[model samples]
Target: MYRYDEFDRRFVNGRVEEFRDQVQRRLAGELTEDEFRPLRLMNGVYLQLHAYMLRVAIPYGTLSSAKLRGLAHIARRYDKGYGHFTTRQNIQFNWIRLEDVPDILDDLAKVELHAIQTSGNCIRNVSADHFASAARDELADPRVYAEILRQWSSLHPEFTYLPRKFKIAVSGSTHDRAAIQVHDIGLQIVENAAGERGFTVYVGGGLGRTPMVAKKVREFLPESELLSYCEAILRVYNQFGRRDNKYKARVKILLHEAGLDEVRRQVEEEYEDIKSRDALTLPHDEIDAIAAYFAPPAFETLPERSETLERAKVVDTALADFVARNLAPHRSPGYGIVTVSLKSVGSVPGDATAEQMEAIADLAERYSFDELRVSHEQNLVLPHVRLDDVPALFAELQKAGVATGNAGLITDSICCPGLDYCSLANARSIPLAQRISERFADLSRQHEIGDLKIKISGCINACGHHHVAHIGILGVDRKGEEFYQITLGGSGDETCSIGSIVGRGFSSDDIVDAIETVVNTYIAQRSSPEEPFLAFFRRVGEAPFKEALYGAAPAAA
Candidate 1:
């Protein structure tokens, strides 16, 4: 993790002080809610359904053991006993008092974390693969670059107040675990024909009312030129992105309107003009310095799978399922990337209790060299756990309710706080998710379903990533009542596409049955268990699921 330099320390402290004064002014009746709204948003505070929600940035999803402990402390002290990890790789406290935000941020700052840029219409937090440093096929660690972008974009005087919120992601591996295709700017670290590593840049991608996959702007930009190239892109967007209509204010809208060729031309012109600026380009030494911060720890070489782990897998079904699903391939020989699923049976999808957070921190220290990652799917990942310690680790995780064996199963859902926490939401997402999970709690049924992603978004902001789930569920308000809409064939991978609405929306009470209908339809239509729900849906259109879901033929329904 990158330590806060003096400049960082000073800037964060200054922002905290400024916000503290702003809160005082608002309380003193000098500023109305409308007047103070944007001010508070800039500090990552939101006035939600019942209380204020504070989003704290976990930069690039990296957290040290001590920092993880700090977050646990916040959960214990200010809000409820848990916190929700979000798709943007940030954490949200759903029940926070307005006055406690400053104190919360102060606590966060003590452990090199803060909520700066977690919200606001400026550039938001940059994300990357949760398994960046430990993944098997990574060409280079992406967090080093993400950290660089964090410093460069934080309170950037030129681009701080942009047309809309901007998000960027970097993927060091060929696999797109970070969902880079759905970001405003996506960078894939690639090695060129000349054998030098750099970035393949994609711009103007986003998921909202209008979802798009970013277009490639640069094939292989030199690593040193990342800052300058990124600045050029942002500068172009800020100068020409629409502001008249809020709906058309995002960079994606601009790209759509201007066409990719025109956008590329403008970006190139800007890049050419700024390429020679000394301060804009990151020097090789500076890149080296940044890289040093995320260098992999010393890994010991050992045999692949230890005897104890094999014996545990033979005995415990839970341990076996965890080893099979939660563990990912690691770059180092005897190690693996282990994900701690926060979506246990009846818990909030992305939430972690204070005790669970502490347990995860301890596990990271014991098995993963004190390094931890918060995945975009709301799971905690120990990116370099030795395979030999799998059994004992799984045992510890079971004790803490962190050993759920459903990573991409129906139970492993991405859900928003919905009406329970988000004021923008029209319906309750958590209860619906819980209902669906309980209905599909049969491990055999879920495994038979196979790698199905069910994402629930309370409203159309797509915060829960409903647009990309294999079975996307969106909660909507129809009059005073709540309804849920389903989308089919959506994905957040190399074959990225926004899901199409399957049929009419279902009532809140009717949603679980509707989901069951969809799943049962997949079970009937799938060729085999090897065929995923999305694959089956894509193969057979909405006809099967729609008929099954509506209990009538397509024309009749």
Candidate 2:
């Protein structure tokens, strides 16, 4: 993890002081809400339906134990006793007071964390795969580039007010774990034919009302020119992107209207002029220095397989299931990556209580390497745990109620804090998510159904990324009634695609049954459980599922 240098500490402290003054002005009636809206947003403070919310950045989702403790302290001392981890790899404290925000930020700065650029989004937090440095299939650590982008984009005057909020994601592996294809800018780190590392750049991908998979704009952009190329793309969007209507202000909308070829041409034209600037051209030493901070941890030589872990699994079936679901392959020999699932049985999807946070922080520091990662899936990761420690870690996690072996299962749903808290939401999402989770609470049933992703959104804002889930649900309000729309065949991996809606919407009372019907249809239509829900949907299209959900097979044409 990157520690704050003198410059970083100074910058954060200065911003804290500035926000403190702004908050005082607003409270004292010297500034009105209209005048303070942008300022508050710039500081990641939002006045939601129930209370003020503060979104703190977790740069690339990497955190030291100290930082995790600091967040837990904030959750306990400042607002409610829990915090919500978002799909964007950030955390939002939902019940913050407007007056205490500066103090909260000061506390965050004590641990080298801040909420700056987390909202109103100059470029937002640069996210990456949670398995960045530890994944067995990683091409490079995406955090190196993510951190670089974070530094370059932080408070950039030129991009401070773009056409709309911008987001960028970087992936260091062939798999799109970071959902890069749904970002304003997506960078896939790869090696060229000549063995030189570079990026396959994609632009204009997003998932609001106008969901889209980003189009590749460059086949191979040298690593040295990453910042320059990103700047070029942003310049094109800023110059030609829609601004008259906030609804169509995203880069995805601009690309949809103007066409990818034209957008590429504009970016290339811009790149030609700015590519050689000293500020944009990254030197080998600078790149290496940043990468050095994210180097893999030292490992002890040991047998690849742990006999003790194997014995523990053989004796305990639940332990075996958890080992299978929660553990991911690590690049280091005799090591594994553990996901601490936040989607426990019936609790909120992405929430972690103060005690839970403290427990996780202790686990990471003790078993993993004093470091942890917040996954975009709303899970925490111990990226370098020894295989021998797996059993002990699983036991500790189970005791904490944070260990539900439902990773990538139906119960492991991605949900937003819906109408319950968000002013922008049209309907309640958490209750529906809780309902579905409870319906699929059976361990055997969840394992029988096999790898399925359910994503729910309260509205079209798509904060929960409903567009790319295998089973996507959207909550809409019609005449003050909550109606749910279901989408199928969407995925956010190497083969990313936006899902298509099945048919008419269902009432809240009827939605769970509708989802169950789809699952049953999938089971019947699939070749086997091995064929997974997504593959089955793709193999047969949505007709069978639609027929099952709505009614019997349609009458002969």
Candidate 3:
């Protein structure tokens, strides 16, 4: 994790005091609600339907045990007893009081955390693969670049207020775990034919009312010129991106209106002008300096497989199931990456209680090198757990009620704080997600359905990333009643594609059953048990699933 320097400490403390003043003004009636809107938003505060919501940034989803403890303290002292982990790898406290925000910000600053850029049109927290350094297939730690972008973009005067909010993600592995394709800017670290590292830059990818897989603007941008190329893209977007209509203000819309070729041309032209700037080009020494912060932990040599874990699994089926579903292969020998599923059956998808947070933080400190990661999938990750310690960790996790073994399964869905909290939402997302989770609560049934991602959003904002889910559900208000729309075959991995709508929307009562019908249809349609739901859906398009959901068309008369 990147430690905050003295300057960082000063900067964060200064911002805290600044916001404290603004908050005091608002409370003292010196600033009206309308006047306080942008100021509050810039500080990552939102006035939701029920109460004020505070979103704290977990940059690149990295957190130390101390930071985790700090958040747990906030959850316990400030708002409700729990906080919601979002799809962007940030956390949200939904029941915040207006006057308490300054004190909360002060507390956050003490832990070197803040809500800055977690909201607003500024380049929001630069996210990366949660398993960046730990993944077996990573070419490099993407967080090194993410941290660089964090430093470069924080309070950047030039790009502070874009036409609309911007999101950027980086993936270091061949697999796109960060969902880079659905970001405003996506960077994939790659090695060229000559073995030099660079980035495959994709621009204009986003999901909202208009979902798009990013266009490949550059085949390979030199690693040294990463900042220059990115600056060029932002400049092009800022120059021509729409300002009149907020609906069409996104860079994705700009790319759609202006052809990809023209956009690429403009970007290249801008890059040519700026590439030579000394400030933009990253030196090898600076890159190494940034990377030194993320060097691998001191690892012990041991066998690849853990005999202790194997023996425990032989006796405990729960342990066997957890190992099968929740663990990922680690880059280090005799170690594994453990994903703590926050989506327990019948619970909110991403809500973690303060007690659970503290428990996990303690476990991370004891077993996983004192580091934890928040995944874009709304789960917590123990990135470097020794395989030999798996049984003990599993037992502790079970005691904490977070030992649900459904990492990529149906119950482990990505959901948003919909109508339950979000004022912009048309339907309640939490209830729907909870119902679906309970519907497929059986671990065996979920494993059988294999690697299915069900993402739900209360509205078209796509906060839950429903557009790229295997089963995408978007809630809409029809004549003041909630109706759920379903889209099938969407995915967010390397082979990214937007899902196509199946047919008419379903009533809230029927939505869960409709999802089950789709799952059952996939199970029956699949050639074998090994065929995942996504593969089956892709093999035979949405026709079969649509027919199953909406029923077959009338026989030709």
State which candidate, 2 or 3, has the greater lDDT. Answer: 3
Query: What lDDT tens digits, residue by residue, belong to model 1 across residues 97-196?
Result: 8888888888888898888898888889999999898887788999999999988898899988999899999999878889988999999999999999
Candidate 2 residue-pair clash tally: 0
Query: Where does model 1 exceed 4 Å of error?
Result: 551-557
lDDT of 2 by residue, 20-64 (tens): 999999999999999999999999999999899999999999999
lDDT of 1 at 252: 93
Q: What is the lDDT of residue 440 in candidate 2?
A: 91
Native-vs-model 1 lDDT?
0.89
Q: Model 3: clashing residue pairs?
A: none
Deviation (Å) of 173 in candidate 3: 0.3
Candidate 3: tens digits of C-alpha lDDT, residues 64-182: 99999999999999988999999898999999998899899999888889999998888999999999899999999999999999999999999999998999999999999999999
Task: List runs of model 3 lying over 4 Å from the truth.
Answer: 554-557
- Give the lDDT ranking, best first: 3, 2, 1
